[model samples]
Target: MKTRIVRVLVTDDHPIVLDGVTLALQNTPWLQVAGYARSGREAITAVERLKPDVVLLDLRLPDMLGPEVVQALRAQDSAVKIILFTAYPDHAALDAALAAGAHGAVVKDTERDDLVDAIRRVMAGERVLCINAAGSSGAALSRKLREHGLTRREYDILRRVAMGETNPEIAVALGLTRNTVKTYLQRTLEKLGARNRVEALSRASQLGIL
Candidate 1:
């Protein structure tokens, strides 16, 4: 049997941008454009009505910030996957979206294939970052690392942790013993004042470290 198509709800303040996105996804057999919204309120309402599998969210909605929309969506249904679509591509915007529970970020100028890949990756349960947009400045991320007081090794370990690696897996990847990996994670948690790995990752992403 064929797999079910991924239903998508798109929101953008600009009519032309919305039209362009709709047109680009029109021919993808695995995706369906379920609805479109021009504002955050409309986006919320449409998302509730459509129960789409994924949301293509514009960062600058006329009525609300993109992060607010993401939070609202998560508050309504945590399972709804959100992909932030933005023209700015700034680190702060990318960090905010991820911190607000966005599954992916795609620049407005991204190639059609890249955007589609982001949607696909998010649907597959992977966090997608548009490196071109996300990597412009290490300043914000570095500052976050400093704030977290994470050593270079701990930073590497946390990145692997956020990617869902097991301690043994991380140890193997980093060429360290499992016990050593666990110790690093413990130190990382204490430095960041995080209660757990999840909280640490969340804090790191917010600080743009992840």
Candidate 2:
């Protein structure tokens, strides 16, 4: 039987990382670098256009964060496997991305062989989270998100607010009523112990909940 090639769209801002990853993927006979995207929007667009089998996404895109990109991509195509390819594996952002429905994560400096293995495993219906050196601190980050007690909707609202989206805009984007968006925002603020949106964002940032 012929080996099937997995098409992968890699999204990262740094040219050097992009080039290196692309080269690494190219070295594998069964993996194809379907396309490259430097920002979250471009990744979404490329996924829509190319319909790649897998997406290797950077956690910090110029436009959107890792979790946001994961949510957006999953919204568009539930079948496409997403892996958060980030340098900050110990950060709360990785936890958020996994919660947002990525297949898993692989640290940016992961071995090329292990990266390939991870992609293959994900394709084979396994979740792969590769945070080798993060140790117990990564577990602590996951705990922090849960301890905040922010529902997914509330977290979504908080992130939107951080992006400067008005309630009406958030409502439209989330497909919720304006009042519903306000309610979620209020819940988020209360959870963060803030009197207002700005303070909420500040506190969330300080707590690494953002």
The model with the greatest TM-score is: 2
Per-residue accuracy of model 1 over 58-127 as CA lDDT, tens digit each: 8766565556678888877789999988876654445655766899888888887888889999999999
- Give me the overall lDDT of model 1: 0.80
List pairs with backbone clashes in candidate 1. Answer: none
Q: Model 2, 70: alpha-carbon shift in Å?
A: 0.7
Cα deviation at 195, candidate 2, in Å, is: 8.8
Pick out the ten consecutive residues of candidate 1 with the lowest summed lDDT: 136-145
Q: TM-score of every model?
A: 0.65, 0.75
Q: Model 2 shows how many backbone clashes? A: 0
